[model samples]
Target: MPAAVPLADNAVRHADGQGHAARFDAQSTCAVIVTHGPDPALLQQVVASVVPQVGHVVVFDNGSGGVDVAGLLAGHRRVSVMPSALNVGLGAALNRACERARELGFLHVLMMDQDSVLAEGMVHTLGAALVELQQGGDVAAVGPQFRDARSGELAPFVRFGFPFNRKLRGGPGQRVSCDFLITSGSLVPVESLVRIGPMDEALFIDNIDMDWCFRAKRAGLSLHGICDAQMAHSIGEQLLASRVKQDGVIVHKPFRLYFIMRNRVLLYRRGYTPRVWIAQDVPRLVLKFIGNALFLPARWQRLVFMCKGLRDGVAGRSGGLPG
Candidate 1:
């Protein structure tokens, strides 16, 4: 056989030192859900829900607060646990998992967050949409509708439009051609991932998915929403909040405000044009900074984060948020 081509510069080589061929046949698919020291019950529920639908489950553990996730998954025949010694940020951890999944020969990899629970038949729904896209011949990635767990209502997937400051909202059950923003419950094709390369690890946590989706779009792949498939997510739970109910219960968490203010500017500078930044984003960011400074505690930290994001953007730094 002819020598295999390297999928990426950092791609692992087979025993003979050439890149290995992909493992999955045309019909088979693999799903990987990333977790970091999540509640064991939630992990079990996530695994139980997903294992039945996919060919295999690879649980990417990013330093789970000393949780024995591997032990929990030990007896399962189809589940494999890969542990990281420390928290390497979401983008890096997911990229590492994608590499392993690619090597295992899975055609499609579903990138899932720990707090989100897959609704019944969610996997099949996404998979069917992917197949439809593939048959249509131009689809690159597919993401499902994300619903708030408490209210049972759909949430908006943030779409950062050009000219930086403007964002177009994608509603639940709406099928649209997106400009590189998908939420936690998204499915990525292994071939496209290899072609586009791993996500920017420097992003560490926020906006990494959007950055990757943008890159995929730039690489000529189409991104779509599978309107039927839905995943219930506990939004703002990781950050502490006093809960209140609207359409669903709203958690008023302070950390989310900080991250949002800091990362939104960073994303615009790195992914969008400067004109967009100056026209749309800067004023909004300034208003946010002022509001946070006046009302939120740890005002200095929020301001510092905003300044750092601006500086980084001006310096042409794209991947990773400030440490």
Candidate 2:
């Protein structure tokens, strides 16, 4: 295959034994796209959308079932694919990506999922907002609003509020402070990573972002959300509408339920969880248990996973689910 070329605007090419690892100018941000058996077309779409906005893009594949990521990214010198033979979980993968970003001398890194597509000017807007927030005080990260790719529904920015609640805040284009932001589309400074520490790899998937955000807050850093910078992403398996509620209920697969329950329980036990989330989650968990039992298909299996998740979470069993 032909060698990849440098991107526009003085992008540097750092040669590795395998191929070239592109480096961007100091002003440019490094973008990290983590993938796990992603759909080929969607991955291409996301990569294409982000490459122009950032200086370098790392496509970190967490065990992609033999997908040829390098082959897919061929001819794009600024984009490189780093694949793992086994799934290292999202937190671990992101930590690795950040390390690579720092090694490349990138001041900031934008985290993205393979499935999500960036909106027009999303990266520029997020980068601008991050810089703007940093000028004020210690800002850990800045994230964009996420819209459901399927339904075109927008998710709200979140903040911890009175009465122990995680209140959704603000509409599009409005900048606001938030308790935690999703991993996807978050622009985090390398300095903050050094100060706050890497993601909690043990929890693996769920609540890792929240844990990081809470730690940043504890370290006197603020997390902000820029509503104008939006990403088209997926939240859950499905959205179930109800006449009694203004917002629909989100459903998830059994495996996801395991991580969701276990991670939250573990976070609470470790004192990493904010009181507000606990207050809100406790009642939500209770209702979820009942709802899944009464309505979801494969009811018994779902219950078993949830129970196992709770048990393991309490017992502090982590690093991929036990067989």
Candidate 3:
């Protein structure tokens, strides 16, 4: 086994071939990978893609359930693994990564999910955009466009709406402003992150990005998506195409709906969610509930869990899933 360089605050270091150590501080940027029960093979691929682009890489495992993350990343000199004993949820894990990044002196953090594979030059592209945007605006963060791994279709950036949400579409190599950007593949400045505050761990899993984007907008910061900077990612376990509708539907596991419904309700209750989104999303949620109840194999279980999620959200309950 190669030697591991121990750093302050529970960080392990690996040395690049040039004997250049990771220089994490106020002047440098680091990549933080927050993962759950991810495929070790895919996670290793993701780490390899990022290690060459950023100053260093930190993997925060949110209960990966016995995957030897340290072993998977064993030989990489630029990577460190922080494994959790149980699922702590995405927001909390990312926050922990951010805390560690700050402690190690990283001024910016590029956040990504374990399965997200970056295109070549993605970090450099986003970093360049961040520098350019910050010169004239309060750029909270810049994110890459997501290309679905299975379908090869690009997901458009979102825009705020009432009754009708809009997609911000751009041609190749274009940059555009957007209302929301998923946490995965987002490059955020530490100073702006501090001002916007840590992610709402209360939501636990779902809709955390939207909540943070709304907060950033309220704080007069702009979020942008670089059209050419792409990430190969998947939104759900399965994607079902609507035979007649233009849009496709992503199918998550039954229990996953709990976090989705609960988080949206909580966001609305806290007044962080826009009235427009609430006006439109509530009806959409109802439609989703109906569709899942009718089509999903685990119909009753999903509906029951969703209803319980709604109740918990109304009751202002948050954190990891309840037993």
Candidate 4:
């Protein structure tokens, strides 16, 4: 395992003080937003949206553009900033934040992406849903329905039921029990973290959320999607289009293709089972490789990524995102 690094010097200072000021209460939840490189304006908007409701807001900057994120958040009485000088990838950064949250006595952690904005009362809505789930005594984590910021339409939250073979889609305003995988807009209880542990930093960037969910399920925790709470996520059109177009293309950009292929196989090896892998993962990967080869600009890199992903998955290598 790579040596565990603290976020950034400034982040540590900010969090250290604020951690003492806003200790967690059982009645309140703390939110942690993870960012790599986010537009300053967008980050501010995200802070403004959640600061009022959550007990505290911690911004985990993963090797951002050296912007003064700590300065930006300094004024807010409830906000603290943590920066990672090296881009340690999202999973590791979040785990660090979760660890901090635990130390601060927070009972729940809300994971947010820097570009996302919660809908009006969305935090309260998710909080309510989580309370309901806890009362029911079965759910491990719960995520809200996500809406596309650009399109203004609800995006389906995909759920895979037991036997892990079939995927069920839950539309907007429809509640569904799931083996919770999606994380961009979700709230997780600290208890779940204590039980299943933080996301696998080994898987690093891709499918880390799903990998966590699968582990939680195996440990006898249930995951669910709460339909009422919603957030608008900026899934940039250009990146989306490229990803869809190159689903199977053997393109160049080895780093991009490498994680896509590697994480898929890693998920399977971890516990996804062969039937599930064949029915879902394989077809998606093959087509992705083909799509990249046919349409993407970096065909050779893409193919190399696919090959490496296959090799790592088969070899059962685990720990951190590929460098």
Best by TM-score: 3
Mind giving the per-residue lDDT tens digits that candidate 2 earns over 149-219? 87677787777765455556577568989888988999887778988999999988988888999899989
Q: lDDT per prediction?
A: 0.64, 0.79, 0.82, 0.68
Leading candidate by lDDT: 3
| Worst 10-residue lDDT window, candidate 1 | 13-22
lDDT of 3 by residue, 1-323 (tens): 33222234333333334332233232266789998878988998898888877777888988888787878788898677788998888899999988887776766789999899999988878877776666666788999998888777888988878777788769787888988899999999888889999998878898998999999998999999999898899887887788855547888999999998888888888665678888889998898889888888899999998998999999999988899
Q: In terms of TM-score, how similar is model 2 to the real structure? A: 0.89
The per-prediction tally of clashing pairs is 9, 0, 2, 21
Shift in Å, residue 24, candidate 4: 13
Q: Rank the candidates by lDDT, best first.
A: 3, 2, 4, 1
Model 2 worst lDDT window (10 residues): 18-27
Query: Which has the higher TM-score value, candidate number 3 or candidate number 4?
Result: 3
